[model samples]
Target: MPDLSIQLLPGLKLKNPVIAASGTAGYGDEPNRLCDIADLGAFVCKGTTLKPRAGNPQPRIMETPYGLLNAIGLQNPGVEAVIEKYAPLWAGWTTPIFVNIAAESVDEYAKLAHRLDKVPGIAALEVNISCPNVAAGCLEFGSTPESAAAVTRAVKNATSLPVIVKLTPNTSDIVALAQAVESAGADAVSLINTLRGMAIDIKKRKPVLGNITGGLSGSAVKPVALAMVYRVAGAVKVPVIGCGGITTGEDAIEFLMAGATAVEVGTAALVNPRAPIEIVKSIENYMLEWKLTEMSQLIGAARR
Candidate 1:
């Protein structure tokens, strides 16, 4: 090991900064079979709602040029089931487990937060304020500062666990939303959730995804994600978790340089379940090559 640990918050210290992004990694069970999730810093489970959702219709995903477009619609087994089934299993693991939560209304978000707070295995809460595929409350809360803040405040008030607000890239002013969540009492922030995008089947003259539009993620969105993370990380005092199109350790380094205290791996896990593990190794190698030890030594070094 290369002293990869980092303190994302005063009390929320991580073994390393490369965590598994939600949706792609299913509550640490699926990937744990292929790769020991305990090797990574932490992993956020798929988006959980107050009630179960069937998600959108079939063909909810489409392959794009450099990434994948998905509209999972926050499909989950509901918060109650999540705790009943996985909390005990997670409690034995050394790696922290943060549950990614999505809800249609502010009240639901708060209620879900309160419920998750009682779960013994959960490490923290990452509010998914940026699910653009939804037509109702999630999209509404994430698209604007007021609604975003409303959601953030509700969850913060409901839970004692550290709350990390995940910001949507679909907004005109991401910085404003970042600040809003901070003011509303978020402990940290994660930026650049997949960009809102669509793909069309030219020959069929129709959209590829059943939802018509989906979130764009993968190596292609790195520049845009990096720019947003850089802007938000510098602007907010809260630690920023950089997510979006990160497929390699080199990409992870770029995000940390851009000012992200940590980074999350999403789409890459789809291609290779071992990507996160490989990324962890790659990061350790980078540390050795640069004669660095602590992962904190790389964070925001580019900005300074």
Candidate 2:
């Protein structure tokens, strides 16, 4: 049998390399119901904030050709509520639970980290640097190396658990952004968050999404994600968790070969609840066919 397990970061080990992306997994409850959570590498819950956000109004999601456009606006319970309600359940699960956190300021980000630190159920923190820093005139923290590093430092100082900075593709230079967080003490990095995109209702003469603009994900973003993962992986020494449009074991293999230690499934799961588990099975099958003994032989194979 091939070994799918991976040490994603110091003290953050995954049984495999297929994590359920945030927003799609919904705190692992629904996905757990659909498939065994134990079969997944890790699970990232919806973006949590310091306070509960109502999120955007109606028509927050729309189906585009070959992709999904979502402006869910990070609707999630506050960190305190999450700990009180879900932490106990996560403590009992075998799979690692990563809380994807988003905030508008450095102080708020640190506070969320501090609040989640030492929690029994949470294994790590995936910082969503795509949130705009209110203090910086609403400039997204992931848009620049300096601001991204600042948030990373604050969060790192607040929590002892591994911090994986989630990079945004909307930035001017993604490689620089990844390097900045790595230098700021990030344990690992994940990319690329959905590309910024939107659609129009020609009949209604208006935008399809309620927010007018939303994040683009699914098959259409795979190539961009693959390129970003390959570039960021070469630029940093930490593990890279590839995400975007991974829908199959073959797609996951493409990312693993590009140097991502693991991959996160988002839109695919939305389309099919069992996508993550199937992806795991697919990887196992691929390993069997390739006669590979372990993940190291397959990971970064393309870079060579």
Candidate 1 off by > 4 Å: 31-33
Per-candidate local distance difference test: 0.89, 0.89
Predicted candidate 2 versus true structure: per-residue lDDT over 133-178, tens digit per residue? 2222113778899999999999999999899999989987899999
List pairs with backbone clashes in candidate 2: none
Tell me the number of clashing residue pairs for each predicted model. Answer: 1, 0
Please give the TM-score that candidate 1 achieves against the real structure: 0.97
Candidate 2 weakest ten by summed lDDT: 130-139
In angstroms, the error of model 2 at 167 is 0.3
